[model samples]
Target: MFDKIFQLGLRDILDSMPSEYVSLKEAVEGKLEISLNNGLKHRFDAEEVRKLSSIVPLYLWSMVRIPFIMVKLSSPGEYSINGSEWDRRAISLILNDLGSVISVGQMELLLREFKSLIFITLGYDSISGIDNDKEGI
Candidate 1:
């Protein structure tokens, strides 16, 4: 059930996103770069972002002890989840590649972008609304 919904949401998001935001090569390589307002940059590889995407969501859900929750859309293609909202240690666990120099705001922005890319590359069901098992008309 979770997988089904996840796929559906992913497809919907991917279809609506712009062409530049949906890159198979970047998704596969897991290469991400974030530029902060402070004129600094942080680089993340595919493995790092993948780990963050899986870990951060689970951690948040674990705290609430819920199996699933409503994922609100804060923007056109971005979910409401902010990774920077997590504790400093938790954020460090994901952005360790850049050491402990990143701020909460920067991490949050990066996370939002990360989520966008993840949805593009991860599970996608093009036939989300179409039922394949239906009998012939």
Candidate 2:
């Protein structure tokens, strides 16, 4: 069906997304690599990792996952952070405050500040054709 084709197309667009996430603690402990959906390895920036470690509390280091997933909403210039509470808390600390939705300007700021710690992807709604259970896409 056309829906299946559409889902495949959406998934293809996310082929470069990370296959798995690493915790901040793991990154700090020299486990700074993640596998991508395309079977490629992506390494985290050491300096960025150090900076993040300094910004976030020690207690959250283990729970906060690296490469925070930012979902681009269906609306233009809007995004939602997709991750656990710990992940959002770390981001909130970095940004001073984080709302349910973030604007494009905020996204740019986050990219500049946490270049190696964030990943942008299409929102579930944007990729509604795709199944939610699919991992790494």
Candidate 2, residues 32-80, lDDT tens digits: the string is 8899998989888999999999999999999999889988776667777
Best by lDDT: 2
lDDT (Cα atoms) of all candidates against the true structure: 0.37, 0.83
Candidate 2 Cα errors over 4 Å, as ranges: 1-9, 127-137
lDDT of 1: 0.37
For residues 12-130, write the lDDT of model 1, one tens digit per residue: 65454333221223433443554333344434456644544565555342232111111223222322222232433344444554343344454465556454332122211222433
Count of clashes in candidate 1: 1
The CA lDDT at 91 in model 2 is: 79
* Clashing residue pairs, backbone N/CA/C < 3 A, model 1: 30-46
Clashes (backbone N, CA, C under 3 Å), per candidate, total 1, 0
Q: How much RMSD separates candidate 2 from the native structure?
A: 4.7
